[model samples]
Target: MSTEPRSTSEPRIAIVGAGPAGLMCARVLHNHRIPATVYDADTSLTSRDAGGSLDLHADTGQIALADAGLLDVFAALARYEDQAKRRVDQHGTELAAFVPDADDDAAPEIDRGQLRRLLAGSVPAGTVHFGHRVTGVEAVGDRYRLRFANGGHADADLVVGADGTWSRVRPLVSDAAPAYTGVSFVEVRFDDVETRHPDVAALVGTGHLFANDGAGLAIVAQRNSGGQIRCYLSMRIEADWPRRAGIEPDDEAAVRRYLLDAYRGWDARFRPLLTDTDSGYLHRPIHALPAGLTWPHRSGITLVGDAAHVMPPLGGWGANLALLDAAELATAIATQPPGTALTGYEQRMWARSGPLAAAANEGLARFAGAADHIPDHRAEHQRYQADAAAYRAARA
Candidate 1:
């Protein structure tokens, strides 16, 4: 495929989805004095729960934030002391523990809602159109047209699909879709943990706790801001396990009982992580696209983040990769012509994310059975610090 440089100095770019990838792209473009429009399905920024906390790695996620000129603000809101981690067995025995040094900021934790609000605020006002759920993408003569579910239409010179797993613009470039990964999570949260759930707070500590049973069952909890703790009870089960097991999703009590039964051999100490919750249960069936997925470059259309190469959440690489993708794409567009920039961005994104996606898949598969030994979280953090130091040195 060949792309010609736009005759006009500026091209009309339309970005689908206002998640991390889309919003970061818009913010970076704004920093470069380029204009782009973003459309999101949510009615507002607070339309739904923004999920849990995320640790932004220095090399990837932080670099993107620095480029968008929000790193300083992020520092103020980041929780540096929450970098601690622990892993335990079904008997509530500690397998491993890692606590970062006081000065270490390699990957600091921040709530998803706070991060989204920070990025959204960095972009120009009116740049994002909420409630504009896109239905389809159609190719016109030389441009792409977006059809919204609200019977609205818009055409643009370039279309970016940062719409995540079930992207509406993905089919225009590739035929790949996310597939269920044979594992699911029932997510629940406890509010005011230090006061209402002191025991749970102590179990979770300042960061994350992973409790695993050798037989394909695990409970993971992480501390969020506002004195809340979010927990996920995960198991290797079919995608339709709820339906097949005759469990109504809306029935919280039924789901809790089912989870308790499933986790039957585990220590009684782990029960509160499943039973005491301030919010309703959220059933999440994990899914991912094929590892190292790539598509032939099509003119005027491209993808970023999960839309390009979505994999199972392992090592918290998904959001970090998305932030890097947005920063790189925006930089390319600012320095190069439209067509060449899109192609170059795609190639670089594929090369960078392919191996990470493969590793994530392998990591997710480990949940199938109990491992002979647990990973050394301290060693992993040291490696990440070394890598980040090298990256900074090279860039300097």
Candidate 2:
């Protein structure tokens, strides 16, 4: 409703997917008085849970939000105390612990749902057209046209693909596909932890705890607002193992039993992490595009976020990089004309993302094997600190 006037000379921009990257891009463009339309598959903003919490890095996520004029709102919603972190062994022994100053905002945690709402709300009401799940994108004489699943179509001078990992728009530019990372997470959530599970809450502390066995098994538990904690029981297993074992996602009891058996040697105290799950388990196998992935420049279309360069989430780079991509792409579009802006954006994006993606992939390998290969928690702790510092420095 608050869109700027459409100029005859201004390119008509169509953004696919209303995730952080797309929303941020649109918000930044709107701030520059550039109008763009965002299309998403969801029927409405609250179509589903927005996944778990995220820690927005200072340079990427925070800066992007600032550019979008939403930093103040983000600060109001950020959970500063969630910076507390700990690493432990199967016996629940703390290998490393970091409790940042309560005021630290360098990388504050925020629920993904909350962040999505803030970004979505920041843009004008009608800017995002919900339920417009894009099915394909095609070039039409120097322009791009989008076809949606629900029998809809639109054409734009510029098409921004923010549709995420399995982006439909990606094919128009690249041949890459997301391949499994040999890692899978059985996601479990517990609600009202402070009241219903005080002991678990105390063990989890203020932020997150990583319990690794140094081989192939690990559990990461992180606290969100509303006294809830989300846990991911991760394993390095065959991609089809779940289906092969007849383990359906909705079979919560079966999943719980499987997890308990897989982590049998783990400390008894950690059992509650699996046994006390409050909802159905979700089997989410991690995947990433080939590291350092890039496509030749094609006019009228480009990608951002997971749609551009997806990597394992081990290095905490996914959301941060996505937000950065959105901001950078928006800046490029705002300054350059349509045909040439994408080249500049892709060049800078690849330079910035290529190394990060490679590092993230390597780090994920180490992280997946930390329980099995790492000699000791102390060494892992040191590596964690070094990686954290390095990421901060790189961003700085």
Candidate 3:
């Protein structure tokens, strides 16, 4: 059940969810001296654990930050030297390594927490109302009334859904829901890798390391700012495999054993990724919305980030696209007439994101199963290079 909103004279612009997209939207609106409020379910910025590092591209993520007057801050916080990427076989044989030049500012790594904090702080105090869990949104006249779980309510002339994968505001504009990909990741963390786990640190190098067996097992380790290495051991299994097998992610011993059994014949070096953990593993089942998803023109509602086009992280375009969406949507709102601005923004967003979403899903399907049939690393490298080139061209 929902309640009707009491009359209020002040007009409001509301953005839901405080992830990168929502925060970026708030920042851009603030830069234009527009009055908007951000609503997030989290009690505080640090209430829970933030995700790992993210690489921001020059054309998308960096451009958005620059528009919000935070590019310099991002540059300062970015891990410029950690742009290297390496792919290897299960036996620890190097497949291909992408080493960026020193002068390259194309894509740089930054901690997700650091980036979110920067965006959150740049906006005016009280602009973001944390702990406001939006329960439902209903149309009231031309505006929308956002009802929260805490019995609080606000009416906004426009509502932007940046609430991530399970967005509450998404149903207003579209009926699309995310479907799980056939892969799942068990995340493991290693602290002070330089001193605590030098072997793993050396193997991971200065940036990202990927070891795949081509069948169903993959170990991906990424170097973070604080001498930390985050590893995700990916496996292709049924969505309910864990529950069916009675595997408890919170049980470290059971997880370690399951991983060891799964990769029994693979290289021994990959053991540390599963064995050397600080605590219980975190299960991350991949999910994505259908490619080319679109909605009918609904006034007073829009979406960004995972809420719009949630795809597997294999393509590394989620955060970048989210930032880009915020930039473009904010511009549309500021420049176009209120009646038609949201429609214009949706058109542009679909044009830009639809292709990327389709490509990402295609890439995921091809790469996830290619290890069995395609053992040649160079071939994989060439395919990746060609795909990347095409994406770059499209962005231009």
Residue 152 in model 2: lDDT:
70
Cα distance off (Å), candidate 2, residue 358: 1.3
In lDDT terms, how accurate is model 1? 0.88
Compared with the true structure, model 2 gives a TM-score of 0.91
Stretches of candidate 3 off by over 4 Å are: 1-10, 372-396
Candidate 1, residues 182-279: lDDT per residue as tens digits?
88988999999889999999888989898887678888799899899999888999999989989887988988888889988988888898799899
Per-residue error (Å), model 1, residue 394 = 4.8
Go through the candidates in order and give each one's C-alpha lDDT: 0.88, 0.85, 0.83
Winner on lDDT between 1 and 3 is 1
Clashes per prediction? 0, 6, 1
What digit string (tens of lDDT, one per residue) describes model 2 on residues 249-338? 578788788888999999889989989988778788999998888888887789999999999887578999899899889988888776
Which lDDT tens digits does candidate 3 get at residues 82-166?
A: 8778888889988777777678677789989898999999989988888899999899898888999889888888899999999
TM-score of each: 0.96, 0.91, 0.91
In Å, residue 374's CA in model 1 sits off its true spot by: 2.5
Q: Point to the candidate with the largest lDDT.
A: 1
- The RMSD (Cα, Å) of candidate 1 is 3.3
TM-score order of candidates, top first:
1, 2, 3
Candidate 3 lDDT (Cα, 0 to 1) = 0.83
